[model samples]
Target chain A: MGGPDYAELCQLYARYAAALDAARWDEWPEFFVEDCLYKLIPRENHERGFPLATLMFESKGMLQDRVYGIRETLFHDPYYQRHVIGAPLIHAATAERITCEANYAVLRTKLSELPTVFSLGRYIDEVVVTDGGLKFASKLVVYDNELIANSIIYPI
Target chain B: MDGAEAVFPDEMTWPAGDVGRVPFLAYTNPEFHKAELERFFYRDHWCYVGLEAEIPEPGDFIRTAVGERSVIVVRDDEGAINVVENVCAHRGVQFCRERHGNRLDQGFTCPYHQWKYTLQGDLRGVPFLRGLKRDGQVQGGMPPDFKTSDHGLNKLKVATRGGVIFASFDPDVESLEDFLGPEMLGYFDRLFDGRMLKILGYNRQRIPGNWKLMQENIKDPYHPGLLHTWFVTFGLWRADNKSELKMDAHHRHAAMISTRGQAAAAAPAEVTQVSSFKASMQLNDARFLDIVPEPWWKGPTAVMMTLFPSVILQQQVNSVSTRHIQPRGHGAFDFVWTHFGFEDDDEAMTQRRLRQANLFGPAGFVSADDGEVIELSQMGFEQKPFHRTVAELGGRDAADSDHMITETLIRGMYGYWRKVMGL
Candidate 1:
């Protein structure tokens, strides 16, 4: 429904990442379609065929659950994050779907620790465009950092 | 148990070639372990630090602890990986405090007092005057105690092969290839294939066991059938006939790999287990399955090898990565696992890989069994209360192994261990 091309579909991505980086969670889920798949995982376990990930969600509700978990439930350092998204390149495209690949890095400044890189990865995204602009059918974050110093939380 | 040198039967004495069961002290004692860290591990031995793929750009950095010493391995301005001690030259405050980054213009700066250094660990500048800057004579200036040149980060010997960075506390350590050797390195290169990597994901776990326990677990294939009922009961792995073979190296490093096949039928009655969970029947559709649709009975399906002391090489189908471990205490360890794929992996392929990626970490059905079992072993071994545990399982001689159940590889490790620990 929007520009009906690659850059438009990708602009929606950079916007979504920027908003989430800004803690605009209310606007975060709007970028995803009804059945969205998202997983934030480290590289070590994945090589050994291990599926335990930092964040694993199969739908928009799961993404919302993660947001809720951070806000209401689990304990983490009260911090702020800003995601810097690189230019996205289209990997593939179909009549209804567009696949975009972009490099992403997040800087999270916590209470005591110095502002450090929270997460860095390649965003392998599949989006479907409808009347509601572009929606994420799935987003897989493949983290570049092998040694995760402490626990990793929040979306990147 | 306290400072009492381990006493045992002549057979119990280790690094000596023998099939007799060795004492458990070799596995449990802090003195013995300290020796291993200092001699074999820290001295003239290669340790996997981080992946070479991590520092992709000039000035990219990752801070990690090799042994207890914090190390900052950063890609310098020229895009070459430089492994330096994380401890700064001036104060003890660590530079590159965060996990990973790119210090483009300004080099690494200390968090505490603002002492700055380049990626190569040179003392670039100081905050104020020589001392605290009184009447042109500052108090507490650069210490006469140690000069900046005299206090460059304690540099360790580092080398790389297969896109994995390895470092040793000892500069005299053998080159990476010589340390790994042709037989072992050849098998390792299969996973490395030398293509640009696309990271899949990562996971971490803390197991209640010595770091060596993890090394032994990956090298000992017997545990797969005996321990991983989650995979077996779910029809994940049927024992293949003599498919699992053990290859031992001089440094106590070993590779345990299983060729694809069904176990020699009628080998053991307990090998097969009945399933209790209904969902077990559903194929998880994880990435390992994505590579080969049918059961693997001909080619090698899984390869698990250790890079000595602290890291593991895991190859499951087309997904490859490393599992690095840091021993927290005599009975504690922090485990890290990384996932990677060729850059050419398609979006659909990447998704299938993520879904099928389940086996060896904390949540892995196959590897989750390990944490429970590792603790049980630790508890059982500790029951001897500073006494030694027995490691000879399949044979009596060190390095003598057959049919996957042998702890001889462990004894071979102890041999190298004693040589390093100078026991």
Candidate 2:
């Protein structure tokens, strides 16, 4: 029994960023376990131990619903988002689970404007071993920027 | 020609006296924006500072804004909340950089010069007031008649009700009760019914549009059924829902109250005709819509109250929040959402509230559309300031109505805007 290696973790992150960057939102939830927690919150609230989050999906079902919202429900000016994720720093590792954190910056380019840094944050993750190699049991995105530019159409 | 006077030429006329048609200049002209700041935010109006829950303990302080001016809301040692301008009296430095913190021991000290003020913003200590002695002779000291009391931080007149706090820079401003009026006060009280509020979290975004547009967004109920697909398709908020539009006597404030339509009710032509509505649309996770009616809601499931140029009190089903509109110049404003729930709410209810909050804020399912549209609207306004917009949905007049089809609320706001702005 062994945990996911550094190379495997990087591959997982690269694939995740690729899917989000290409707007293949339908495949987003597949990177997570069935009962997963995905939350995007500000550092202000996180440091203060607040319960609010910009987007909180408790289960994979909720993430799928969000995908549905991005695809069918929400109407906005379509834009492209590129994720620049740093190397993951492993905090702890076990045969069944691993904990890691990484810095990330999301750049958004509207059809009419130049690319701008839309969201600057770090991902605090808890990955678990499953048949699919590695999946996120909990993914918490804590953004450092206090004010957002209009709205965040795509997930960070 | 002077810079200030040149900006105010005589050619900026509103499109109509009835306020049914508004010119783009209202959102484009910088001079008009400055006038708006003076008339609406700076004087004779109680602008929201922050919740009392935010500064519960003595020495707790949070830096907030009244319009574009920075102010600090703090709880003093004697259990009194005070709002003081962040600008220091000496040298006019805008100190107090941290957004929120507990400054119990040292009070507020300006880093530029060690000028200390009490928790109540009273000027208490000034170093070397008699000048430092280098050769046994006093030098570079203030005049003997200089008084510390006169140099205190600019304290605002604060009003607290039901744990919410509002402050006014104008000393002659009317009481908060009178400012809200009787009708608007009822809706305000209904949401803030004297219960201790537990802060859930916050979501802040800078919308690249006029601040008034954010007020108009909540007031204009015509958009929810048309613009927000999640609301129309899920029967959460529709034009056909039993709704009422109300306004203060001055028409500066409004409350858009709507009861959720019956889920089993057949789709009427009003809803079916909407392109955003899809009969097949359903949530993969039903918990997002797991709305449990509370006793405080009374009847209406949603009540969006725009409290004039400062804040919007929102109660959309299970989610509750305060949306503060802090204007920045004419083209942009910072919209901050403070999501909260009552202190006595059970764990299940709290979770429900947080889940339903997904439909709001910067990344909200329904509200994200609003932010985008507002930005686009501003771009259009800047492109052609001579153009005008038509708000003549129900009629050319502004009045309260029983249905959500009317744009009366927006018309009502512009009516008041014209009177106060003298445009």
Candidate 3:
């Protein structure tokens, strides 16, 4: 099955990672369609078929609310996050949608501390070609680690 | 400063038995941590294990910890739940590695040596104990005095109440009812209420701070309005809200009860003055604040209970959970959140519980700040071991309060800590 060009899909993931790593949270929802699902869940629950997720946004509106929270509501020590994401492996594709998965490692560095491996996960995503551009229809971040650090300040 | 050294030793000091001031050494000293584990966790205290819903069928088990020591909570053939140490009695190995599984009828077996035990942790089979025959003669047989019953796994005293479970290392410890006392037991029953529990899911985070800090965080109502923007802006928790602080007779267990007030367009000067409060903040998806009150809540919209050394029972609006504080050492602890719902809840109620849960857990909108502050607080305590923290929000004494503006619960906890630790 063929949808968008492989290079275009690669560019979409690259830009998404770049935006997240830079903490450009406002640009996050733009990567997804107006109606989308974004979930960051531990693999433990995911494998058990449990619905609980570390962070779940059922709609793009919910994603925007989280952005508002990070920008205006939440109080946390400022830190920098870097994402090292692997190439996306497309599983299936149609004229309207594409299914793929990619591995990711997020490294975080606090102002006074050294860098640490904050999270290790893989993204299972559904991409669709909208009039604007290729956007995520659904993205499920399944983290391999059972225990998270003190908190997940930003989206993985 | 004149008689500071005389009244207090160099290792640790408190101001004449006053619970208001807590020493930094309490969170930094390794030796003191061991004493706390012995006095507060291992003896006389019933630590929260897991919900009965976790192991519904025979042979179902979940591997957990009782103050850092691995243990298994399983269901036996008789349908009675048992709490057994995960250690192999022979080689002293923690045999169970999986966090959860079904033991079925086979029970547990140590890998190093095929020493088998029943679901109740009784020694059932011992390979080669009777010895195998070699040609014409038997070799390496156990002595006639060997008895499997004498070599069974260490069994913990177990208690079950309204689907919740607790276990203790001390057999003579008080019963679960007496341990919680009347006031605390009423609050416990409000949440548990004999209703069947449905396990939603779990969230585990390693907080780099003392385990007691997690308890103190829930106990101290002063920080919720000041530190959590989501709580303050959304009116989930406020300084002026109708609230009350209640503690057990021993002051080791506590409950913070609060009823959410009307959301006013113009907030009071006191609340608006807080750094975390945002008057104009709003959720794009208003469903997060779509709180549907349950009959169990009675009047209060939220009730956070700290059950001494082990767990925190939470009933925050539509979301209810158990926060288990498993200490690793003086410096760190594992905070496990078990978000559950009543078995009678409908699909809509379950979804509401799940959505409202966004306000908690490690990455929660309100709770993430808690984990961060506890970590930073531990750092401060470690940096200056001689320094002490001031917990004189409402007053210098620890007592039940009628408002949410006090640190009385923290003081009360340290009051119990001082008595138990003898420091």
Candidate 3 lDDT, tens digit per residue, B221-340?
Answer: 988877886777876766788889999999999999999888655477676568656677677788888889888888899999999999999998998999998999999999999999
* Model 3 lDDT, residue A109, Cα: 96
- Residue-level lDDT of model 1, residues B1-423, one tens digit each, is 343653432233444453234456655677666766666556777767788777788888777767656788888887777788887766676656677778757788888877777777677777652677678765886555645566566676778776778888877776788888777887777777676666555576666677778877776665676566544543445554344455545746677665545422332344453233222233322233445422221367666777677788886554456888877766767787777766677776665555455444554445655765676677667655444556657665565343665666666776666565555
- The positional error of residue A4 in candidate 3, measured at the CA in angstroms, is 0.7
User: What is the C-alpha lDDT profile of model 2 across B1-423, one tens digit per residue?
Assistant: 223332433467665576978888788989899999999999989999889999889999999999999999999998899999999999999989999999889899999889999989999888888777888788787889989999999999999988999999999999999999999999999999999999998999999999999999999988887788788677787677899999999999999999998865557765656765667667778898999999999999999999988999999999999999999999999999999999899999999999999889999999999999999999998876766799899998999999988899999999999999877
Instruction: Give one clash count per candidate, in the order shown.
Output: 33, 0, 0
TM-score of each: 0.68, 0.97, 0.97
- Where in model 3 is the C-alpha error above 4 Å? B1-10
DockQ (CA atoms), all models:
0.07, 0.84, 0.78
Q: Which stretches of candidate 2 lie over 4 Å from their true place?
A: B1-10
For the predicted complex of model 2, DockQ is 0.84
Top candidate on DockQ is 2
lDDT at B35, model 1 = 65
